[model samples]
Target chain A: MTTTTIPTLPAGRTIKLGLSRIRYEVKTYFRQGDAVFFSFLFPLVMLTIFSVAFSEQSFGSEAAPLSAAAFYLPGMLAAGLLLSGLQNLSIDIAGEKGDGTLKRFAGTPLPVLSYFIGKIGQVFATGILQAAMLLFVAGVVFQVELPSEPAKWATFAWVFLLGVSTSAILGIALSGLPRTGKSATAVIIPIALVLQFISGVYLGFSLLPEWLQNVASVFPLKWMAQGMRAVFLPEDFASLEQGGTWDLPGVLVVTAIWLVVGLAATRMTFRWIRKDS
Target chain B: MTTTEPVVSVRNLHKRYGSFTALDGVSFDIHRGETFALLGPNGAGKSTTIEILEGYRDRTSGEASVLGVDPGTGGLAWKARLGIVLQSTGESGNVTVREQLTHFAGFYPNPRDVDEVIAAVGLQDKQKTLIRKLSGGQRRRVDVALGIIGRPELLFLDEPTTGFDPEARRQFWQLIDSLKQDGTTILLTTHYLDEAAQLGDRAGVIAGGRLIDIGAIDEIGGAEARVPIVRWKQDGERKSVRTSEPGLVVAKIVAQLGEPEALEIIRPSLEDIYLQLVADHAAAEAADLMENAS
Candidate 1:
């Protein structure tokens, strides 16, 4: 006979199950040699290439090794998180759904919210670590100095949080569209390149055509990267670029707007599974 | 009170995806403590109805009550009372079976002891093994472990023994019998009719999004269900007869045949009755469609 006893807990609440799921998600995330390749190795390789290749593009007196690298560091960091939150997240989620993992979960008492919290939590924690690693390497290897002002550092933290949250929701939204891993990659890789090219990750907006710059400005990538540069790079150096003044309010607003839009898209596009497809 | 209410009551339930009517007016009630097997072919609205009753989908019209609560708006307390064992898969296989059971234990207010439940399902030795490493049967036991962890008042078993070998299937039936003895109401859906006869207290046959028959396992097809067909060849003359009292018919036939050439009486199994019922249902539906056209 099955014997059961009630556990002690508050009467009504969705047990966040947050910490438990995060622990499991991270454990599984690291176990896959493939995930480690995209989340960690990809960003490190990109950072090295940009810092080395553009070592001679001078910003003030020195070659752009430090300044250009520092300016684009946020984009590369966003790129690492985008790999975790957008590129890798969408494909893996779609694969799990196709593999019947999500259907298995539907049988449990675990809340629907747990999957999102656990996955995004893993990405967010990794995002923070990726950010820290970038800062450590930039400071130690390239000898780049962050702005001495306390306000800029605080601004950097908040903007990073908002940017990652927005990206994570977009990840879940995209997962609903593809049914297979091959299709997921086809959708993700091109979007990644297009956003990186236009948002000043590879080349500055000044070098891109006016029409392209105008298009890139509409994306959250541009604002997130520019906000990070405002915090780390010297103000006099940053002033050389147009609309380049440290727009703290603009960074917050753009990311916040994306966050809302991402959530709405999630509700509309999300499917537990496409029964017909 | 003579069976005051059914454990599950679904009335005039309808569901649509855009213009397609996935389920059109499906209705049935499962009585308390009865293992009512729902049998249907694929795309016959079997899954759609079950999903709605499980509170995973919403109905476009009509009402559904599982354990006296509308599943459409049912909350955690109500959900806690139902055990659902889905199709077995290795998706949650990264964790050991014991670890997996313990993790699910945290969700329900009252949950069966993880170690004890593991042993009940004959998985004690394999408790430390990752779910992925276990055999298909053992992984199915894990699915069972998670389902019954909460000691649910009602259990929904969806094709629980689909991949099981004969030995494993019998063992699973034993586990189910123990659960039934403890007064857990069960609603099962399967394509296997022998399984239904062996385990179900009652069975229901559904076709074309509607339930055509529901009753005790032996009486599912009414009086005609128990009747047997006697056949024989005497002096090169083939003969056959269908009668309700098979014993009397057999006795009379035996006297006439005098142990003559291959006299035999064949009784209908649940599988036979079930197939006949569904076939008759389809024929009736065709006739109705024809009549309406005229």
Candidate 2:
């Protein structure tokens, strides 16, 4: 250990550092077998179950025949996004906090904000990839039709981006609530399962009780599923919606609100170190 | 040494959590190219003080400057000058040792070569192993590797060798010694008194959120505290005397006893003084509590 002169590091090195963090996050996520399974395989399993049980069944009246696979395809995609962006992401972040990973990062020169940006980037990328896989399976095996026109695809892009961003941010924020790794699943999964049932992912929004619809509407998952339905479902299917219309603009407004709220909550609740109390 | 500005300095630092005080009016300085050790038991505020210096926690009051900048508002450049090895780190265990080190090296503008650091920590053979597959002691080597990768001007080691075996601990000491030789200012906290005596130029003992004593390692408890006890057998009875000058006492005993039987000169080890200091502090604290209760 000879005396090595340390060069003064340049200020504002967060960009490069954050990029490195993102690279590590992506690499680590792919390498972990459980993470790979949950993000990619678990969603596929859920899609298979729903499609097998309700493929030929049609909902609503004889005027419009909406097959169960088609109706549930959009909902399944929304569920996939939620599973990756919210459930998996939150548990991972909370697990890091529980095990002292966040605390260790706090001691480094790397900015805490950069660490979060890296995590969010990983979540967003995984969510997109999982959504694409689910879409492929639904379109090919289940024979569900995707959006044809450019406008509907555009809707899918914004809704997917906004929904994933909102959930990722919410995951980062809710990570602070879990005290340990053992409790992270308990803390995040119950909320995810409840939202899946009430937010029209496992069941049709119109079939759910009116009061339940109103309650679920306040969450991002409901808006995400509604937006996806608008992008995939036909024009007449809007009659079965809560407002008896697609309400694409309302979906955008609701999701945008969630994006803002999630970011704010993350800023307020993110903890670099887990307190024992 | 007095003419040079301290690389790390603290003045009346305080940290409080509601009604509880973690650090109370603690002050110290580590000169450039010096290895300063902080010795204390659990909850003695050693970690709280170290965290404040590392910019991981904020102080309730008083001033602290590391590398001439306040840690509370230190920017990234300021942080780049520090190498910190926490007591217990939670690392993502999926990555290999080399991959983890390579990723961390990018955070600094100029960092030591990753392979060189891995070799310095004696982990060259295990660089390709996943962190989770490594033993507890081997993982600690990774922690140390990350700490020194940036060639930091000052390294903060909080119990850097807690789980290490005897050989590993000695190797770690040599690594620290080499870093010190290269003129990197070091501030470390350890519960092991021998570790402090072996590596520290100076040591401070903290108890009950206060720095009770600070001085050169050999003189931490003061001249009186370092007094040696001379024990000898006289007329089939044991006799002992404590004195600052052991040689003089021994000669006098020999002159009186015509070569004393079973002669022994026992000096107070750092551990002995440390325990005495903590015990004294606990007694004082209990008395204060009793007085307040009455």
Pick the TM-score winner. Answer: 2
lDDT scores of the candidates, listed in order: 0.77, 0.85
| Tens digits of per-residue lDDT for model 2, A1-277 | 2332334666566666777777888889998888788665786887788778876677636886766677787888888778888887889998888787877776677788779778888887788888888888888988877778999999899989888888888878787777788799888889999999999888778889999999998888898999988888888878888989888788889888878888898877776764421
Q: Candidate 1 — which pairs collide?
A: A57-A64
CAPRI class of candidate 2: acceptable
Q: What TM-score do all the candidates reach, one by one?
A: 0.84, 0.90
DockQ of 1: 0.21
Off by over 4 Å in 2: A1-12, A55-67, A179-181, A274-277, B1-3, B232-239, B243-263, B280-294
| DockQ of candidate model 2 | 0.38
lDDT tens digits, residue span B1-294, model 2: 233778889999888988899999999999999999999889999999998888778889999988878888777777788899998876668999999999888877779999889988999999999999999999999999999998898999999998899999999999998999989999999988999999999998898899999999988887887788899898899989998888998888778768889999999999998898889889999999999999
lDDT of 1 by residue, B125-178 (tens): 999888888888788888888889988888988888887888878888898999
Q: Which segments of model 1 are wrong by more than 4 Å? A: A1-15, A51-60, A63-72, A92-109, A136-152, A173-182, A234-236, A264-277, B1-3, B15-26, B87-96, B121-141, B230-265, B289-294
